[model samples]
Target: MTDNENLKTTPLDSLHRELGGKMVPFAGYAMPVQYPAGILKEHAQTRTQAGLFDVSHMGQARLTGADPATAFETLVPGDIAGLGAGRMRYTMFTNEAGGILDDLMATNMGDHLFLVVNAACKEADFAHIESGLGDRARLEILTDRALLALQGPAAATVLARFAFAAATMPFMSAAEMDIGGISCLVTRSGYTGEDGYEISIPAAEAEKIARLLLAEVEVAPVGLGARDSLRLEAGLCLYGSDIDTQTTPVEAGLTWAIGKRRREEGGFPGADVIIGQIRGGVSRKRVGILPEGRAPARAHTEITDADGSVIGEVTSGGFGPTIERPIAMGYVAVGSSLPGTRVNLVVRGKALPGAVVRMPFVEQRYYRG
Candidate 1:
């Protein structure tokens, strides 16, 4: 176990303690796993109202240079050059073997492309970006900023109270705005599968802005535990678990993230292998698994066929509070990947009944408008 003394703290660390949050080490940062409200209530709060998340641990950086987008396109599969100013796209950094290094959000910030990378992989990801782009793009790691997520059905309504422009921002759009007198870069996107905004604020002002948002009636402080459950129910991929150095985007069910132009042109790393997988198909693919019983199938739980042949293992799983059932996701053979395909989840030497199902066990309520 990681020692708490060695862990880093977010700008909202003191505030989390004041709210009785149980701080746990996550990606080297001391993040709140749950508050006095607990994970269940936090989950419900975000689903029904707004949950403020201190996601300051996430890595924020900027890529700037002449034709940075086109230069960046050489590293990832996404259509970076086509990303209009203020628009963001979900993408991944793939290795030469066509496996994901890290999943990230890239936004064309007009002058430079802003990137938000997974905290655990941020160091290596930035290094990879710097090595790949060389002089073509200048990487500026934003150490002075902190990120906060305001998520749920009432996110827009709550955020609008501070930044009126947030109410009208379309999904996947970003803008520089002032919220309650603090400058921030706000993006209408989140991992929770809800209409929300991710605000990038100066580290010095994060706690103040967080307090301002939490003071509202509809907003509450949410910890990481609920955030994980929320994203799991949304069927979103967790970087290291659901995808890794060996999982290709095609096999991970993220082929759509690879732009059509990149597919046809074939310039990015491992383009040959990924494009081939696109046309010829892969041996195994990621799929949603619904266990029949209330007992949740957890990570590394063996998935088997009727005859008890091991097919795959669950990568992410747990009780989904919103759906009020045990939900999971993992990779299985193509033959067993379809929805409604009966399977078994081996837990503690017992084979539990399950079935392959389509993802987003709960509908994603992203504010597309």
Candidate 2:
């Protein structure tokens, strides 16, 4: 639905163009899909070294109230009340039908809950949140901020220069710190399933911070292409692609995001159906698919059994530069969702041999330490 003719640009837009970024329309923004180094090199670099991503298009906001957690938990089925200060949790805003409106990260910043939602759904998401919790909470959209993600194995090493304790910060934790002399909120989490930081700084200083991060020996400026590949290899679901209004957390392999308290209290929207699914299970589930040979299976590719019966369809698929092979994830009937289950991905006209495999085709290098 994004119109290519008139798309919003991020703080790093000019810088990205200067670096030879292949500009494209993404989530209504003029974003970079790749640089001259290409998607393959960017993917490999991020897996082995570090890659910087401009993610300012993502929605950032703060919820402040007498009890922000309780107010926010009305829409999301997560234990917001149980989150400790400076901790973060991945949760989804579920609709009354037990479907996801949007998936987001909520950080308990002591005084309030800091939330970041998907770029494509921000306007609708904020409106939904505001209409529901307006009386109980004050929503302040951080429009002046720019978000940057520094991800990969070498991420912490590069960021530690500005904030030494960054190397020690546990995954899914956030802190207000100064990076390269700029005041920012740094979260020791990212989409790539690696040790990293998502920094939120003033929009005016975004390009400056990005340049500083890229100046590091191990860091390279990556684009949306590598970001998608990295997250796909991590087995993370894409907002509209793998999950959406029709998909529930249980169906999308995100049951872990629904906390015990929320599940037991049953106050959130769609609790009736979601809780039922938690107890009874779903008919189909999101699973990993590994295609044999060099041909990469793409999104919407039909997943079929050996007998040519359609089982599911590919959601996100691409070649993982780090794994050096084609990897994909899609929804399949529960009977065929188990790892090692033989399957076929109908690519173009041929049924390519594949298997329902365990997710994170590339090992998660998260720093639990």
lDDT (10s digit) by residue, model 1, range 213-316 = 99999999999999999999999999999999989999999999999999999799889899999999999999999999989999999999988999998999
Per-residue alpha-carbon lDDT of model 2 for 226-311, expressed as tens digits? 99999999999999999988888999999999999888889988999999999999999999999998999999999999899999
Worst 10 residues of 2 by lDDT: 1-10
lDDT for model 1 comes to: 0.95
Q: List the residue pairs that clash in candidate 2.
A: none
Q: Identify the candidate with maximal TM-score.
A: 1
TM-score per model over all chains: 0.99, 0.98
lDDT score at residue 220, model 1, on the 0-100 scale? 97
Best by lDDT: 1
Candidate 1 lDDT at 327 equals: 99
C-alpha lDDT values of all predictions: 0.95, 0.93
